[model samples]
Target: MALLVIAACQLMVVLDITIVNIALPHIQSALGFSTTGLAWVVNAYTLTFGGLLLLGGRAGDILGRRRVLVFGVLLFVFASLLGGLAQSSGQLLAARALQGVGGAIASPTALALISTTFGEGPARNRAFGVFAGVSAGGGAIGLLAGGMLVEWLNWRWVLFVNVPIGILIVLATPRWIRESPRHPGHFDLTGALTSTVGMVLLVYGFIRAAQEGWRDPYTLASFAAAVVVLSLFVLVERRSRQPITPLHMFADRNRAGTYGMMLSLSAAIFGMFFFLTLFVQDVLGFSPLAAGFAFLPVSALIAVGAGLASRLLPRFGPKPFLVAGAVLAAGGLGWLTLTDVHSTYAGSILGPMLVFSLGMGMEFVSLTLMALSNVPTRETGAASGLLNATQQVGGSLGLSILVTMFGTAGRSEARQQIPRFLAQATPAERLRFRRTGQLPAPWSDQVLTAGVSAAFVMAAVFTLVAALIAVLVIQVRPSDLARLQGGPDPGPV
Candidate 1:
């Protein structure tokens, strides 16, 4: 029952991350949102979710995990309803931001519940495997669900669909989950506020840099504010009697490595989904539903790889699989960077996506296990909260950076082609180029391909960095894991 409740809550939170991508176009049209405003639909949720995750995790420790989980579900449900009925862009963005708060509150509690419920051993390992699979699979599932909902029904149904699921989970929680024992630490209000505000400012700066350039006054101010706030947050954490993120948590070398690896890998993985979705819809002329279906292969491979990793991890140790997964994922991204106008789904996209998913699947499972492997029962909530927070931060930061890169590339390509079009073109042709930021109809393909290729290259670089981090850091062996679990120490890797 605990597993079911936690898994369901996790599914809802993770699904929201990608589910709205397919609905963006529909939402923009219906609500009459400007291009810049439409991005807020995604950023609003991520900003709040990433910022407050540590606070939410700490809340679970101070109060009760079950109580916090229930509150999160209720808040999420109310926010979803508001979003579904939104009459304006402002209302919808506000609702999405509120939904992020609820998600932040609920997610860590779910992981903490699993840690407390399942004793550390094969049983706990298996539970975490399932949990990891659900976490990785949620984005793909959301894409598919969003496409189907937007195509068959109105885009509003994408938000409304969560209402029933949220209600069902809330109803089951009282019966299914038990309350966690409360700790005697005071909430580090100062730490939470500074960290949350710092992250928000940092992400906002990167995102705005895409539109307004790095030199823009607001963008520079945002970055400067982030640095000051985050610096203060670290100072506060060092002095606080009850630090929200205990400094001792980073003492474990393997755990620290896993956290860093997760941040880099998550950035690449989430950026792929963001740009790929845009490519399929905007460049390839795929409908929302069709684009969703295109991701089915990758999704299926991830599930398979995750299930396989759970069993294989106990035998082979995490290092080999982690290294192999990272290398393969990097390779796949490299292949994807070759995408061009003539590329076909089977010949060009499918192979790389499947290979990438396989690597991501293995990496996610191993990294999750490594992160939680040596966590004491008392610190389980804090550990899991930090891991989740890293992924959220990575995703938010990565997407913003990649988007900025894409925008710059697109503008540069457009600028290069303008002179070519002007040299031999009539007055009407030059006017069209000036107005639409591209040559007349036929040259759209060249411009889009260049932009997408540039984005994919950036994603590839991100994945390569992740692979290097895994190789350099994360050195635990199967025997070491056994020792960590109370068995004999195996020889070092």
Candidate 2:
């Protein structure tokens, strides 16, 4: 029951990130959003969730996890209601930010619960397997759920569905979930506030650059604020007795490398989802439900990979799987770059996506185990929090850069192709193609394909970089993992 409660909460939190993605067009239409402005529907949640994750984890350590969990669930429910009721873009964005606050509090605490509750070794590994599997596959689940709701009911149902689930989790949690022993410490307000604000500025800077260009005054200001605030956060952490992040955690070379690798992996994953979702619906003219179902295979395979990797991790450690996973992921993205104007889902996407999804699942297990390995019990929340923070920030930044690339290529290709197309195309063909997004045969197809392929190439580059980092830096052996299985901190490998 306890595991169910925590896992359900984690699923809810993770799924929200992608669920709204499928509903984006509906939300945009309803809210009357400009193309660039619509991104905030996703960004607002991730920015705050990533930024405040450290603080949320620290709170779990200071306050009991159960108490924090209840509060977080309640907050998430309230925010969902607000989001469902939102009538304007600003209102929805605000609600999304509030949802992030709730998620930041709940997610790491839920992960930390696994370490504290299950005795390490196979049992703990099994528990982590469940947690990571759900976490990893939740996005796909969201796609299906969002598609159903948006297609059969209304777009607001995507947000509204959370209310019932959140309420039930809140009521059920105290029955089976044991609270962690609260640590006595002052909240590192300076460290927490600075770090949160710094990340927000940095992510916002990337977002601003995507729409307004790097030279925009607002984009420049955002970057400046990110730098100054992040510097101050480091200085404050160095001095604070009860730091939210124990800087010394980075002392482990393997852990540090895993974090960086996770960052790169997330960048590719997030960008793929954002762009592909658009390609399926906007370009291919699939309904929302069809779009959701298209991704079902990838999601199901990822769950399988995560489960298998979790079982194998206890015996083989993370290195082999991480290497293999990175290779497969890079290969998949590389294949994705072959997507053309005439490419079909089965011909170009499904085969490569299967390879990528499996790799992604293994990568999730490897990264989660690597991040949490050898940490003291008290710091589990801290470790989990850092792992998640990188995920959000990496996704946000990667999307910004990739979207900019996609927009630039798309505009350039359209300009060149459309003029030439008009010269040859029948007037009826031009009018029909423009009105319905129908391509004028070969030329039109090639142009859009060029744009989408550029984005995939960049995503492939990020994954390839991750594979290289894993090979060069992460060195934990199977034996090293065995030592840290059950008891005291074995210190850094």
Candidate 3:
């Protein structure tokens, strides 16, 4: 029952990430968002969630885990309601940020609860496997659900859907989940302030740079603020008693490598979803529901791979799976680059999508094991939060960076076709086209497809680097799994 509660909370959090993605086109049309700003719907949540995670973890300890969990879920439900009711972009973004605050508290606490609730060995392993599988499939599940909701009900249903789930979780949690006794510790306010503000500035800098040129004064200022603030965050962490994030957590080569792998994996995969949604709807002209179903295979393959990895991990260790998954993901992403305006779902998208899903699923299972395993129990919540932080920051940073690439490449492509398009337009049509500022049939479609393909090529590069890190840096061996089975502490890397 405890494990089920934790998994359900986690599934809800993870589901929000990609479920809104399929509805992005609809959201943009309804909300009047520019392409550059549309990403904020995703990034706003991630930024606050990632930035405050360290503090949220510590809060669970200082307060009680179950107490924090219930509060977080309630907050999430409220935020979801606000999002569903939102009429303006500002309202939606604010609601999303609030949702992140809830998720930040809930997600790490839920993971930590699993560690506290379940005994180590097969019991804990089984618990984590269930948690990991749910999380691994959540993104794909979100895509499908988002599609159906947008097609049948409307885009708002995506946010509205969470309210009921959250309400049920809140009601059931006290019945099933046990609360840990509170610990005595200071809140590390200075550290929290520095880290959260720094990350917000950093993410804003990336978003701004994508819209304005890198030389824009606002961009430079945002970047400068980020650097100065984050440096202060490190300084605060080093000097503070009971720091929100203990810097020593990264001293282990394997643990540090796992963090890096999580970041790279997130960067590659987040960008893939962003651009691919555009490809299917804007390029292939699939309806929202059909586009949702298009990604079903990827979700299934990921679930399969995650289940397989859970079974294999105790035998082969995390290293082989991590390396193999990365290689497979890179190959899949590379194949995605072959897509063009004429390509069909079956011809170009399906096979590569399967390959990507299989690889990511394997990586997800292995990565979770590597990141959370062998940590000191006292630091588990903090460690878990940091891992989740890496995923959020990496996604926001990578997507913002890739948005620049997409926008620039797309505009350049469209410019070449403008002269021909103008030649075919009548005087009145030319005036209308200019007034509306819309791209014509083939050129518009070609530009979007080109940008997405380019982004995928870069995503492949990121996954490949993740593979290199797994090969050369991580040192955890298959024998480590045995140490885990015996119920003694899994030795740190």
Q: How would you encode candidate 3's per-residue C-alpha lDDT over 1-493 as one tens digit per residue?
A: 8888899999999999988889898899899987768888988888778877877888888899999999988999999999999999999999999999999888878877887799888999899879877887787789889999999999999999999999989988999988898989899989877987887888788778767778999999999999999999999999988887788989988889999999898988888888888888978889888999998898899888887887887668789999999999999999999889998999999999999989998998787767777787766666777888888988887787777777666777777877878998889868977997776688678877877777788889899999999999998788787553445543331
Please, what is the whole-model Cα lDDT of each candidate in the order they appear? 0.81, 0.83, 0.85
Query: What does the lDDT come to for candidate 2?
Result: 0.83
Q: Pairing residues by index, what is the TM-score of model 1?
A: 0.88
TM-score of 3: 0.92
Name the runs in model 3 displaced over 4 angstroms: 1-5, 114-129, 175-178, 311-316, 476-493
lDDT of 1 by residue, 1-493 (tens): 7787788899999999889988886787799863334556887788788778888887898899989999998999999999999999999989999999999999877887887789998988888868876887788889899999988998898889889999999999889787889976688889878887898788788778877888999999999999999999999999999887787888888888888888878778877877677667766778889988998888888777777776777678888878888888889989998998788777888899999999988887778778887888777667877887888778777777777777677677767876777888888878877786546644656666676677778878888887787788777877666755445643331
Which residues of candidate 2, in runs, are more than 4 Å off?
A: 112-133, 174-181, 307-317, 417-450, 484-493
Candidate 2 displacement at residue 412 in angstroms = 2.2
Error of 2 at 151 (Å): 0.8
RMSD of each: 3.4, 4.0, 2.9
Instruction: Point to the candidate with the largest TM-score.
Output: 3
Clashing pairs in 3: 19-142
Residue pairs in collision within model 2: none
lDDT (Cα, 0-100) at 311 in candidate 2? 80
- List the candidate numbers ranked by TM-score, top first: 3, 1, 2
